[model samples]
Target: MHNAQPWRFRYHRGSRVFEIRADLERAMPHADPDARGLHIGCGAALLNLRVAAVHEGLHPETLLLPDPADRALVASVGLTGAAAADSGLGALYPAIRQRHSSRFPFDDREIPQPLREALGEAARAEGAALTFPSSWHLDEVLELARESEARNMTDPGGDTDLARWTRLDAASADTTDDGVPYDAFGPRKRGGKSPMRDLAGLREVAGRDAADFERNPQLALLSTPRDHPEDWLRAGQAVERVLLLATLEGLSSSLATQPVEWTDLRWALRDPVSGTGHVQLILRLGYGPEGPGTPRRPASDVLEVLP
Candidate 1:
């Protein structure tokens, strides 16, 4: 929900390499000046590509931020070699298509411990950490998020990126194929109590209904060792890993970058007991209505083949 997808790709036919690049032109200057969200989104795409490659009997090896000179170059995924793909990763292929951000209210259902552990392992596999905070800690995190949202919504020029990417206009929604559609808005909050951000951005959703979200929002913080470009990339990959696994396990997830998008709020989001890692993303997982699929620009629009 960080405005919209601000990334592009280049697939070299000759080298059989697929590359991920952060499109600064589409970046949210106000929301993510450091472009951390940009890298995270690209990293998520890289994960999906790897899973798809494994399902198709190919191996995808990644090189994060390969060229330091070109900072926009997020990663290069080499879809080469006939090495046997990891079956476990292939198992998540279906979830790639099934997973979408769910902002709707979720039932008061507790996620099993084993599933939580498994999700933690998934993040660890990508060199990141996902920790579901305790009850009192959750209240703090949600308050931090609320404060951040209040700031973002009120700050001048804060809505710039959101306005650019939200395809709410009737003509825009029908013609162009990118940005969050109105259907994916997940209804207005209507004073509902949840950590989910209202991505609608002041746009009116006709016939939409608002309800009370889960009071005990199942929230988790995805963090990395340090706050660098590479670390951001790792956190992004871990996000996709955990999200795909959650989808497979019948859990719907939403992201609250409101807290993580800001500096002070993000620092407060870290677990007090263990204050080592840099929090990158705030994930909300629960059982709820699946968000409608938003439009995506075709691969041809973003991908280019090298001679």
Candidate 2:
């Protein structure tokens, strides 16, 4: 989440459809120049809406990149069909609020195999691939994250995106409608091998404590068949699906997007065995304290209904 809601929605009352569009003002020109992150985020929102609709006894049919000419129109979701809702999606309604990008360290204890399989299945159901890499592959991905982070910190222009979205003060955290608050920054990594980013970057928080994160983080990669606007949308939906399921399974998670954000390193992160071309997001999952919920704009602020 950023300092502001990155998407807006137009609800077509007559058709019972919600059309999502990117808010360019919230676009990160440096970090997300292509607006890929924006679309992914909206895609996640789309998935949430679907789950909510299912819980309300409706089926949500979504169309990604609904308008070829209007790139800003990311996706459109319409309620279709009657009851007989998707029980699985309806089950995830509670998770939507519980899930957050936990930056805290997880326990050294491993996640159960059954839970891991469930998460992979959730991703597949949304048309994306999630793979838990071997130890060697995990090492490579983490190294790349560190390198990417170093570059982002050292370069003068790299943090423009972060500067706009992160609120460091307690007052701002309490007042802001969006953006990650200081309380949710977790601890400065004094140690451990987790791939969680320091949203604070070089800025030091006076009382923010530091802690040791898990060395062997449960790392998974979400990927797609091809890299395109629609694929990113699908990847976004897949990400939210996996996250909701993980939340329901009593796990907290965070994203390691640095590796995937950098073009050079992202290519290297492909599964050498499968040679998958599209590596979407790096997911770190395990048992940890769930991150605090970041504030979101009320539906009124982000949504408009037309007769």
**For residues 101-145, what per-residue lDDT tens digits would candidate 2 score against the true structure?**
888999977888888899999999999989998768888888888
- Candidate with the greatest lDDT versus the true structure: 2
lDDT by residue (120-212, candidate 1, tens digit) is: 999999999999987788779888988988887776666676676776656777787777766677867766457767666666766778777
**Which ranges of candidate 2 are over 4 A from the true structure?**
1-4, 83-87
Q: What TM-score would candidate 1 get against the native? A: 0.94
Score candidate 2 by TM-score against the native. 0.96
Report every candidate's CA lDDT: 0.83, 0.85
Task: List TM-scores for all candidates, in order.
Answer: 0.94, 0.96
Clashing pairs in 1: none
Off by over 4 Å in 1: 1-3, 84-87
